[model samples]
Target chain A: MATFHFELVSPEKLLFSGEVDAVVAPGAEGVFTVLKDHAPVMTVLKPGVVEIDAAGNKEKLFVRGGFADVGLGGFTILAEYAIPVAELDAAKLDADIKNASEDVADAKGDEARRIAAEKLAQLQELKTALAL
Target chain B: MPSLKDLRNRISSVKATQKITKAMQMVAAAKLRRAQAAAEAARPYAERIEKVLANLAGGVSTGAPVLLSGNGRDETHLLVVATAERGLCGAFNSSIVRLAREHIQRLQGQGKTVKILCVGKKGYDQLRRNYEKNIIELVELRGVRQIGFDQGDAIGRKVIDLFERGEFDVATLFFSRFKSVIQQFPTALQLIPAQISANENEAAAGGALATYEYEPGQDEILATLLPRNISVQIFRALLENAASEQGARMSAMDNATRNAGDMIKKQTTLYNRSRQAIITKELIEIISGAEAL
Candidate 1:
C-alpha cells in the first residue's frame, strides 16, 4: 500500500498525524493539492478547509492561514489556527466572529480597518467551514 | 518557641500547600508538552526561510536591502524583549529582562541611543519602571488566548514600520529557549540586519536544507522577507518562552512541594519527640510520688 506521510499542526498542538492518500490546501494564490510525488513548494497558506483521504475514509479540518512545506517524501501543514470538525464550538465561534465584525466596523483608519476586516473574514471562513 | 497547636496548624497548612504545588506541577508538565511541540514545529518554517535568505543573500551587496545593511554604525539600537504574559514561572520572564537590562546598560554606557518594544505584559511591566522613556511600544498579549500568525504578522508589521522610519539601526531580541522540564537558556539574538552566522547555518539540520529561489529580484524578495522574518522570529520566541515558562514552573513547583513535605516531616518528628519527653517526665514524677507515700 502507498501512503504519503501527512501531518496537520496548529500552534496549540498537532491536530492530526497519520499517513493519508492526499491533501488539499488553500494557498495564497488558490487551492492546491499534494500527492505522493508532488514537487517541493513554499508558499503562504490561506484560511480554508483541508481535506484528508485515506483508504476511502475522509476527514476535514478548518484552518487559518500560515505556511506549508511540501516535499517528495511528505507534506506538513502548519496553519496559524487549526481545529477538527468534531472539536469546533459553533456558538463560541459565532460570537467571536460577531465581535470581530464589530471591531472591523469601528476601526479608525485604512490600515486598522483592513486588519480588522481580514480578521473578521478569516473567522467567518472558519465558521463557514465548520458548518460543513 | 511556637505552641503545639500552632505547630499542628502549621503542619496542616504545609500539607495543603504541598497538595497545591503538586497539582500545579502536574498542570505545568501537561502544558509543557504542548508548548514544546509548538516550538519544535516552528523550526522547519524558520529554517526554510533562512535557507531562502541564504540562497538569495549569496554575495548580494549589503546595500541590496536595508535589513542586510550594516554600515558599522552603532549609534542607535532597538531591543525587542519578549516574556510571558503572567508570572510565577521561576524567574523565566525576569531572566530574559535581566539580560536585556544588562545589554541596555552597556549600550547606554557606550553612548548609543536605545529603543525598546516589549511583546508581553510581564516584560513591559518589569522594564517600564527603569526604561519607560526608551520603550517605544508594548504589544500586549492580554487579548490573545493563543499565539498565532496574525499576531506575528501584526508584530512584524510594527517592527518593519519602525525600521522603515529609521527608528534604529540594529534590533535585538531577548528570550528563553526551551529544552526540557529542568533546563532552559536565556537567548539573546540579533533580529535586524539578519545575522545568520555561518556557524548557525552549519548547525541547522542538514537533511532539511535545500536551495530556494526567489521568483522576484533578491532585493524585492528581501523587502518582504526581512519584515516577515522579524515576526516569525518573534513567533518562535514566544513559543519557546511558553515552553520554557511551563518547564521552569513545573520544576519550581515540584521543588516547593518536596520542601513542604520535608518541613511537615521535620515538624511531626519534633512533635513526637516532645510528646515522648513529656510522657517520660510524668511517669518519673508519678513513680517518685508513690515512693514518697
Candidate 2:
C-alpha cells in the first residue's frame, strides 16, 4: 500500500498533517478524492464535509470555504474554517445560521444579498446534512 | 529631609511595582512563544499566495482589477496603522505611530488627503491626538485573546469597501515586523493598487515556467485572488503585530524589573547610612551630657 502526504491548514493553526491513504474534499464543482500519485490540481472548495482515511482510521471535518492544492509533493487544503465533526456543536451552528440569515436580510444591494444568501444556503445545507 | 517612614514606603511601592513587572514579563515570554510560532507557521500560506499572484499578474489587463490597478488617482490615502491593544510594551506602539505620522505628513505635504483606520486601541489613541478628525474607523481588539483570520477578513473587507466608495485611492498598512525577542522594526506596506516588488516579480516569472496551471481563465482566478490576497496580508500583519507586541512587552518589563532592583539597592544604602548618622549623634549627645553632670 502506498501513502501520500496531506495537510489541512486554517488561519489559526495547522489542523492536520500526515501521510494519508486518501483524501476526499468537497470542491466547488464536486467532491473529489485524492490518492497516491494524484495529478497536481488546484481548486476552490465549497462548504461541506471532508473525509480522510489513513491506516484504516476515518476522520471527517466540516469546512466553510477554502482552497485545495494537489501537488507532486502531496495534498493540502487551506480552509477558511474547519472543525471536526465530533466537535461541531448544534448551538453554534444555529447561531451561525441566524447570523447568515440576518446578513442576507440586511444586505444593501444585489451583490451583497447574493453573497449573504449563498452563505445562508451553505449553512442550511450543513444543517440538513448533519441531521442525517 | 524626608522621614525614614517615607523612604520605607517608597521602597515598598517600588518593590510592588517590580513584582508586577516581573510577572508581566513572564507572561509576555509565554505569549511570545505562541505568537512567534503562529507567525512563522503562516509564512508558507503567504508565500504560496504570492506565488499564485505572480503567476496571474501578467494575465490581468492593465487596470482591470481596482485592487491591483488602483482607482486612477493617489490624491486620497488610507493609513491602516496596527498596534498592540495594551500600553506596557514600551516604544512598540509609539514607533509604529511615529512612522505613520511621518508618512501621513509626507502625503499631506504632497497635497494628498489622508484617512486613518486604526486597527488597535493604542494606535488609535496615539493617532487621535493629531489626526483625530482624519480618522475614519477604529477597530479595537481589546478583548480578543488571539488574532484570527476573521478579524483580518473584516478589516480587509472594510478597506475594500472604502476603496470601492472612492474614499481612498491608496492604502498603506503600518505594523511592526517581528525580527527577534528584542528587535522589531516598523514597516509600511502598500495595500491598495498592490505593488509587486521587482525581486518578487522576477522570481515569480522564473517559477512561471513550471507546470502549474490555473483552472478557469487566469483572469478569473486573479479577480478572486487579489481580494483574498488583501485578507492574507492583513492576517499576516495581525500575527506579526501579536508577536512583536509580546516581544516588546517582555523586554520592556525586563528593563523595568532591573531598574526597580537598582532603585531598591540605592534606597537601602541611603536608609542604612541615615540610621547610622542618627545613632552617632545620639551617642555623642549622651557623652557630652554625662561630662557636664
Top DockQ: which candidate number? 2
lDDT of 2 by residue, B1-293 (tens): 66788889889999999999999999999999999988988877777677556655754556468788888887999999999999999899999999999999999999999999999999999999999999999998988887778899999989988988889999999999999989999999999888765445575567532555555445656676778889889999999999999999999999999999999999988888888888999999999999999
Q: Which stretches of candidate 2 lie over 4 Å from their true place?
A: B58-64, B196-217
User: Can you give the TM-score per candidate against the true fold?
Assistant: 0.73, 0.92
Q: Compute the lDDT of residue A130 as modeled in candidate 1.
A: 58
TM-score of chain A of each: 0.75, 0.90
Pairs with steric clashes in candidate 1: none
Task: Give Cα distance to truth, residue A37, candidate 1, Å.
Answer: 8.7
lDDT of 1 at B104: 98
Number of the predicted model whose TM-score against the real structure is largest: 2
